[model samples]
Target: MGLRYSNKINKIRTFALSLVFIGILIMYIGIFFRQYPIIMVICMILGLLAVIGSTVVYFFIGMLSTKAIPVTCPSCEKPTKVLGRVDACMHCDQPLTMDRSLEGHDFDESYNSKKHSKTKA
Candidate 1:
């Protein structure tokens, strides 16, 4: 078995989308507790919070993505955004790196961490 890698921005966006679905599911589940007013209210409130959290996450990622470096993927020749030192091409799964020292190395998400870089140095 081999590990799979995906674009960080896409991953985050997927997570946010899932959160919206989860929030809706929670709210739907609350409908069954209509007889228990307190429990129903609690569930509704929790669901609302989850949806709100998702909104915030979407907004934050959108802002962060705007700051990401735009580069053309060598494999696909399509434009994509790189979030950190190492990120897979958004269009193709080709591993990419901004640091020359990291070139030719196996793809590892840990390389994006400050602690990992410090230890490597």
Candidate 2:
């Protein structure tokens, strides 16, 4: 775990984009198994399924976007949607918090957890 925490939306987007490439690669590999029609068909179906799964995931992200908190990133001076109690800026990766008590303090993702926050309280 490095100190480079990414924006939640950006992370999910990356995953979805990677999934598309993986699905394509899997489908391409199916061509190599042309001698076995059944196996090739199965591989093709699996690859298609992966692509469909990614579409569902992307849709889920869209649904979640409606629930995210919109705020201006102090560091970037641009509006971004924060997905959780703690999230990084979409533009600059600066840590943002919805908690007033934690403002202007060190950025700790733990503050978003109920157990950790309660223990600190």
Candidate 3:
């Protein structure tokens, strides 16, 4: 199967959503431990923390969105946000890059790493 690439912001949002679902699932599982009040309380508290963490993550993404560069995807002609040196078009999954030297090179997410920048230097 071919590899799938997603926009960075979308990936983070998905993680935040998963955290919410996981938190709910944990709380639901705690219902089975009704006989042990201590375990139930612990589970409930942990679940609440997860839900709160997700809220923080969502807020962080909102802040990042403001800093992200808005560009029109050439392939889709749709406006999208690019978060780093390389990002996929949100609408079309087409890989995009801001670095001219990296253009036409294979799309590798490692290109965004500090090590990659040092290599270029």
Models 1 onward score TM values of: 0.93, 0.87, 0.94
* Cα lDDT tens digits for candidate 1, 54-89: 999999999999999999999999999999999998
| Error at 49, model 2, angstroms | 1.0
Clashing pairs in 1: none
RMSD of each: 1.5, 2.4, 1.3
Sorting all predicted structures by lDDT, with the top scorer first, yields 3, 1, 2
Q: State the weakest 10-residue window (summed lDDT) of model 2.
A: 112-121
TM-score winner between 1 and 3, please give it: 3
Clash count, predicted structure 2:
0
Mind giving the per-residue lDDT tens digits that candidate 2 earns over 43-89? 89988988998998899898988899999998889999998778899
Clashing pairs in 2: none
Candidate 3 residues lying further than 4 Å off, grouped into runs, are none
